[model samples]
Target chain A: MPLDAMTDVSDEALLVLFANGDQMAARALTLRFTPKVMAHAYRLLGNHAEAEDVTQESMLRLWKIAPDWRQGEAKISTWLYRVVANLCTDRLRRKPGLALDAVPEPEDNAPGVTERIQDHTREVALQKALNQLPERQRQAVVLRHIEGLTNPEIAAIMEISTEAVESLTARGKRTLAAKLAGQRNELGYSDD
Target chain B: MNWGIAMTERKFDPVDLDHLFARVREHPAQPSADLMKRVLTDAYDAQAAVTPVTAPQLPGAPWLLQVFRELGGWPSMAGLTTAALVGVWLGISPPDGLVATADSFFGTDDDAYLIDVAPEATFEIAEGFLQ
Candidate 1:
């Protein structure tokens, strides 16, 4: 089947196609997932280069398991999220001192408008604050707030109860709010 | 601009938290081309690794079994076996006219026992031993 027609195909269906040796399915899955997984990794690890490595490793694992992927067992994106989170944890463990300092600075040229610069600053600030959180709290908060994933989905990715996810996110938010409270005026939130 | 010490104790409701979440969501990091390239390369490599390979033809099997395979496996071999048996049966109990035709083509059937051939010559050779 043509690649264009694959837009509506489910990830599981595309995986089936890939197991059957459809290279186009591989390309489709790659295009569909890389950005989301990479971004998720970036949020978890607070480093762009490490995020890229984790993203590639996570994707490679998906490809390796395609042939044996049992239908209805797990959503592909959920599995990828879990893998990215775990890989990020491993990377973070290997370099304990690596923190928000390693996170890339927000690019200044692309969002040329004045308001967007503030938004970028806010995002960069939020990421730095997130890095200060406990690993589980950071994962829960990013999956819940930043990624906009549901509590149940975050639970599945974190292998925790939904109630636990809620607790983590709530605490994470309070801490984050406290961290950002002092800078609200400087980040242009006082005018809001 | 610190909103005094009260800012330290303020609670951010869901509506307020949305402000921070929105910034990260709206400005998500994109996967670089280099990362995409590495992922694609891994995908192709992994696909090749997991693909099933046909097992090599079974070697060191008995010759008869191999011949059985060469003769189109079991079904066709059964047919060939039946045909061979029928040929043997036909040759053994041929039709009445087939014997005459075969005799005419390949001379008469002088089938005889060893004792019947040259009995007098055998008796003359034994006469000297009796004397």
Candidate 2:
């Protein structure tokens, strides 16, 4: 399949094509999925370099499994989510007690614009709070709240029941709320 | 009376948690294009590493296994070799001829002995033992 033509095909079909040694299909799958996986990794890991690594690793796993890729068993994006999540969790475990606050700021080009200033503050606080969450809770919260995955989709990704996903997300939200409660006002969100 | 009772009632409603998380939904951080490019490049490279090299054969089947099957199954070849060895052994030494040689060395009678004994068990016997 041509890369351009793959746009019309479903991810599952593209993967099957990829398994058949279609380079265009491989490229298309990469282009289609890399950004989403990178964003998920960045939110989870809080570093661009690490996120890139995780994205690559996750997509490589997808390629490796393409031969046995069972259609309709699970969505490709959902599987990527789980792979990236596991990679992030592995990175976290390997470096226990490292704080997200310790992340070095990217070099600023100039004096902050209003939007930049607001974004920087929120990003810092959010990353810090996310760092404080337990691994599973962090994964659940990121998938559900940040990545906008539904409970059932997250359940499929995490290999858990929907009820378990609900419970995990609820707990994750509560934990995030408690962690960020003090900074809510600082973040400029007035609690009603 | 119902209206008066309803007017005094106060109800507690569950908080709208979605409203609290509303900010996060809109605050998605966009990674730089360069970062995305690097990541995608790495993914492409990794995918290349994982994607099986195409042999001039069917996809999804291991090339080595296919090769093995194409060149005769191992067990069948072993069975053929074993059958050939047994045939050679049987041809070299026929089973029925071996049994006949054993019967001639001792005498065909029910209580026959290989040695011929005189009435008083005197002289030696070595003549034509096969008879």
Candidate 3:
């Protein structure tokens, strides 16, 4: 089938097509999920280079499992999220050091310079605060607040109960608030 | 109690985190094109490994042989078994001894019935017998 026609196909159907050796399915799947997987990994690991590696490995695993992939049993995105999260966690476990250079580089455009700098500063501060959190809390916070996933989805990704997810997010948000409270003025928020 | 409840409600709206959420949400880190290329290559390789290739059917004799091969080879076990049974039946139920009968009728040697007869009469007798 033509690539244009494949746009509306579901991921489950695409995987079945891929298993049947359709190149278009592979292209569609890669285009559909690589960015999400990369972003999810990047949030968990905080390093573009490492996150990219994780994305590649995760995609490779996805490709290998396409032949045996069960349609409708689990959503492809959810499964990719779980793979990325576990891979990031494993890397974090092996070496407790997160590279300082993992902070995103600032853009060099001369326009809107101050706003961009401010945004970058806020991002760095948020990342720093997130890094200080326990791994599980960080995962929950990033998935829920940053990725905008629902509590149940976060729970499913973390393999924890929904109540546990709620607890972690509550605790995580409180800690994040306390940590960034002193920077409120610097971050340009109006005084309470 | 009213004052305490009001304080709790106010505390819920403390810090403005819209900026933080917006920045992270807006600028999710992206994988480079090179990374995507690598992934696609891997996908192609994986797909190639999975799908089976079927050979085209050969023409004429080869095609016929292939058909037989798929049917578990020609002259099957059942056919061979039937042929063997026919052979065994023929051996067990032998026909009467045709060679002995022929010798008695024509006289094999010395005391041959046609020995005393003239050649022409013998020929006549043999011709009559045949008729």
Candidate 4:
């Protein structure tokens, strides 16, 4: 199948293609999921290299599970979120390190307005504050805030109740508020 | 009650985090080409692992032989040939041997010959009707 031919195909359907050994499905899925997976892993691990490794490993698991993946039971992205979160949790447990030292670089160096530069600054500060949070808190906050997932979705990914998700995110936001209190003025936020 | 801290917490609605979240969400971390290549390679490897391999067709074999090969191969063909040989043997063998086998199946030798679908009177009735 042509690579673009799968553009309209659902992720679950694409996995079916992957199960059938269709290389096009592999390419299409990789192209589709890699960026989000990479960004997500980066947000969790905060190390580009480790995130890359996690992204690759997560995708490897996905490919391997294609044969037995039960369609309609779960969304591919949701399953991926669970896998990525679990993998990140394992790595963090294995070696405890703050993401402060490894703030991500801008994805590109495109010349743009000064606003983007400020946005980058704010992003770095946010990541630093997020890194200071407990892992569960950070995962919840990132999923709820950065990834824009709903509480219910985060609950599914984190394997927790929605109430738990709400608590984690609320506490996470409070801690982030404390950490980001000073940077607010510099990050272009004004009471006015 | 620490109403002071509670009051402080209530007042501190989180600062506008939308900007920060937007920056990260908008620019997804780019995956390196090497990583992409490795991922696709793994996908292909897993695909190869799961896909069943079919036996290659034997070269220069007749279709009939191939059909037989598919139908349980040599053992089944041997059994079928043995059965056909037995049938041919029974068909061409002398009537005496067939009668003996029939007698064994029925009862005594006379009983094998005596067993009939209908009496001779039935054949006469059919002949008279035709006339």
Classify candidate 4 by CAPRI docking class.
medium
Cα misplacement distance, residue A38 of candidate 4 (Å)? 1.1
Chain B TM-score, structure 3: 0.34
| Predicted candidate 3 versus true structure: per-residue lDDT over A15-121, tens digit per residue | 99999999888899998899999988888887788889999999999999999988777788888888988898898888789673446456777688888888888
Off by over 4 Å in 2: A1-5, A99-112, A190-192, B1-131
Classified by CAPRI criteria, candidate 1 counts as acceptable
Candidate 3 structure, TM-score to reference: 0.72
Q: lDDT per model, in order? A: 0.83, 0.72, 0.82, 0.84
Candidate 1 residue A98 C-alpha distance from true site, Å: 1.7
TM-score of 4: 0.72
After the best TM-score superposition of candidate 2, give how far the Cα of residue B128 lies from its true spot, in angstroms: 82
Question: lDDT by residue for model 2 over B18-128, one digit each (tens)?
Answer: 543455566554556775565456545656666665446555777766766676758867887899999899778878777578668965766466455564344222344
What are the per-model C-alpha RMSD values against the true structure?
A: 12.2, 14.4, 10.5, 8.2
Candidate 3 clashes between residue pairs 3 or more apart in a chain or in different chains: none
Sorted by TM-score (best first), the order is: 3, 4, 1, 2
Q: Write the per-residue lDDT of candidate 1 for residues A24-64, one digit (tens) a residue.
A: 88899999999999889989887887888899999989998
Off by over 4 Å in 4: A98-113, B1-11, B56-131
Q: Is candidate 1 or candidate 2 better by lDDT?
A: 1
How well does model 2 score by local distance difference test? 0.72
Model 3 CA lDDT for position B66: 78
What TM-score does each of the candidates earn? 0.70, 0.61, 0.72, 0.72
